[model samples]
Target chain A: MEMDSGERFIVPPVNVRETADQIIVEAEMPGIDKNRLEIMLKEKDLFILGRRAKEEPSMGDPVWQEIPHYDFRRVFALGDHVNRSSIHASFDNGVLTLRIAKAEEAKPKKIEVAFA
Target chain B: MQLIRRNRNTTPDLGGLERLQRELSDFFDWTTSAYPTPFRTFGLLEGAWSPALDLYEDKDSLRVVVELPGLKKDEFEATVHGDTLVIQGERKSESEQKKENFYRVERIYGQFHRAVTLPTPVDASKVKASYKDGVLEVILPKKEETKPKQIPVTIQSE
Candidate 1:
């Protein structure tokens, strides 16, 4: 990819899996701290941002060079069946996992058959 | 003499130190011209990206711990290049079936680079790095110059 000034450095890669009740989103965000991560749901979109604090040297004479030290931002558009109000997220070991349940009315239900 | 003329020409009106600072800053900017744009943006908060590292210092050595989850050990490579310690790694995405439907996707991937400048010079020849349970630990022994020294105090009654 061509390097652009406006482009963000960190773009999280996500995987989406679904079950009968909910959708699971697993995002790989290595080298990111959980405390710096923010997750929010607005309408049918999910926004995720994570920031990593920089480290200052303690002893040696200082040297200068460029390093990455900014917040990571990503947004995802959700589907209509996704129940935004019940969405939940957790960050562990640099990975952000989100659980979004499907609306009750959207789930498949079984019906009993009567013999005539 | 020629030496006095050179000194006068190089020195600024502000002060010798101020002139040197300006010259040094300019040199740094020129040398980093090859850096990518994102690198420059992130460098604005130099040493402010990663949180305060939890350091465990003992008499013999110091251990620094950083949290790096979802990254496999083989995916990361750490090296000491000059005064900078570089951590370069890639988080690959899991393969997906062509027929799979993605309702929502939110994850980050691609190359990641983290360069940490050691507070005190470390014994790069004997450094150790290990990752376990989502944490990366780097052990660096203090160089001879930065090592602590013991000073004895003699008690005298006057």
Candidate 2:
């Protein structure tokens, strides 16, 4: 759902993890459409912004509301060792996943032990 | 090599009451590790998390829309139990295939249960539910008497 940006409220919750080959960043963002999401990569910093689709006001009395609506914004400082060109992103369920591949030289290398 | 890892794992370096809280999580309490705030886990424990819900009655039916992002249709169970509409599901944690270090953690993962007491009696058999883009919408047709009636008045002119 495409929507003109509304008020930015809270930073969506996220879990970031690094591995030998890639760094995975997962953000919990429900009610956000892929068309309204923005991902930016600059230098060594990565920016993620998501906007919750505006709910069309319907005719009816609201019975219950526990979830407050809000947009999502977060920034992460990636290191110079990350491969900028290989970054990948996909959204599923209500979570956004961003995979930042590491530079070739940054991957963990196992040294073979030799006994003479 | 300096390995700088700032992660809030299942077991962190916390002592005293915080440690007690963690233990409570093991028992009946489930504090979504990544939630910035803490849910008291001492008495009756709330499920790991409860998705936000909106229930309303329209002209023809009662509608319910629940927020449960990242969950596949099969991952959640939604049904009307007695007078309550129950939605329950689990948010799986990302796999630890070849993890090195984590920089930040905030998302909460685990099981969740949300039950809303339906206000009006509805036709249980006609309930329809659909899950898309992490949202669940359930529509229940209202009973005959419960529906709003429109009475038209005939013009009485001499």
Candidate 3:
């Protein structure tokens, strides 16, 4: 059984980067394991979800506690340049990293300068 | 706990009444325990949050776990000073940025430190730390004297 303090739905910090070949999205979701993390892509949106068990009281009373247990649900709008099928993900040190390679058509091309 | 800021002037939400209520308990506020440095905690500013920490002890060890996402293994360091455990780290933003490219920035940067006075004595030398999945785990084994002792008593049958 879980008690709902009405304190849920956290927006974890996210960083989006555009490299020459791929778009890298990294989200900070500490204390969550791979099993609890859910990543989904729907059309132009990428959704990341994670659930963390509530913070329980330990053996002794706490002198001060400012943090409440939180679950994470964050979404990012993905551009058409990304190839959704080739997306790769890895979780490490509480950070979730997702790499979506850019489609060949999206890669920039330098037109050769024709000498007149 | 004391909170220290250079100059604490921030612009409030412009979304009026509805936004005001949401902003009031906004979890992104800097004091939201995601940023655990500068000696104070629980500050509430829009879109600002700090890392949260948990400290608990078992019969043989005291554990300190910090939720530090988006940080590298070398970014954090933990040490024992006197009877206290000190953790210091820095999160450097990977992007220098084109300014306009950012949709939203909630992750915190700069150096942060937390010095916790351990509940009891611990074997300082044996303290171990590991960083994985953005969480830093510090296991401090309790000192010999601090471990619970079991004493036997003579049976008294009258």
Candidate 4:
């Protein structure tokens, strides 16, 4: 389905990887300002909103143009094992890196054998 | 009249208008401008880099702010040709000592050019450009004719 401009939501491309202790989500959001970006987590869902500004040209006169002004937002559903309270996000340059550490119960535990 | 009436969500007939608006918005957001064959193909292959633009219009001029991360002031060039503003720049990836274990890479690199057309004529002579913290701001003073004029009011007893 085509996405409407006023839809206020987008599915940003994301890469999710699970390590021993945390699940990392690297989202590509080039051109977005760190200050203008908003990150939120509620329950098992994460939301991101940001705007990507366009460059203007310094010409004596503008007779024609093409670019348009717009913003983007995305929401993702996190797995049950994710620790919502421990989730951390940071924006560097334009990429948004999210780290969600898994709950203690979610990690595999090594059980020792009892010698009788 | 029919199309307008059909679009009224308040009324059952407004469904068409709602649909049209949704369609138009989708079209605007996803569609790319019609460029020459080479440019059009390049845009398709390299992904459309529309980069969100914010234009704030004031009494004297219009200010445009563009987010351009990883862009250096010297690496990019901006110029106004007629009513169009063109920004061309190259984003080079940082040097890597070894090409080992390189998997998926999606970041855009190489020369990129974006052009924006002003809705109203601007006084190009008063244009100013500044770059800070990876954001590029351009100020374009509107032409005298395009600036909103405040009509003088003569007090008269009615």
Candidate closest to the true structure, highest TM-score: 2
Provide a comma-separated list of chain B TM-scores, one per candidate: 0.54, 0.63, 0.67, 0.59
Per-residue CA lDDT of model 3 for B38-149, tens digit only, reads 2222224423334577777788888887777767778888889777887777776555534324444445665677667788899998998887667787888989998999
Which CAPRI tier for candidate 4? incorrect
lDDT of 3: 0.67
Model 1 lDDT per residue over B1-158, tens place? 11011001111133546645645664575346432111112222231223223445655566666555677768878787655566666656443333445643323334556666555677889889987535677777778777888979999999
Two-chain DockQ for each candidate model:
0.16, 0.48, 0.32, 0.10
Cα lDDT of model 2 overall?
A: 0.69
When summed lDDT is taken over every stretch of 10 residues in candidate 1 chain B, the lowest stretch is B3-12
Candidate 3 second chain TM: 0.67
What class would a CAPRI assessor give candidate 2's docking?
Answer: acceptable
State the lDDT of candidate 1 residue by residue for A79-108, as single tens digits.
788788888888776678888898998777
lDDT by residue (B1-158, candidate 4, tens digit) is 11001110121122555646744654564455221001121122223444445556666776666656556667887787767767767666432433323222333445566566766789888899987645677888889998888899999999
Candidate 4: give the TM-score of chain A: 0.71
What's the lDDT for residue A36 in model 4? 72
Residue-level lDDT tens digits of model 2 in A49-95: 78777775572777767556776776677787889899899999778
Pick the lDDT winner. Answer: 2
Ten residues in sequence with the least summed lDDT for candidate 4 chain A: A60-69
* iRMSD, all candidates: 8.0, 3.6, 6.2, 8.7
**Model 2, B1-158: lDDT tens per residue?**
11111122232234557757655664442223222222333222332455678877877888888888778767788888767777777767554444357765556556767677788888888999987667788998888888888989999999
Model 2 misses residue B5 by how many Å? 37
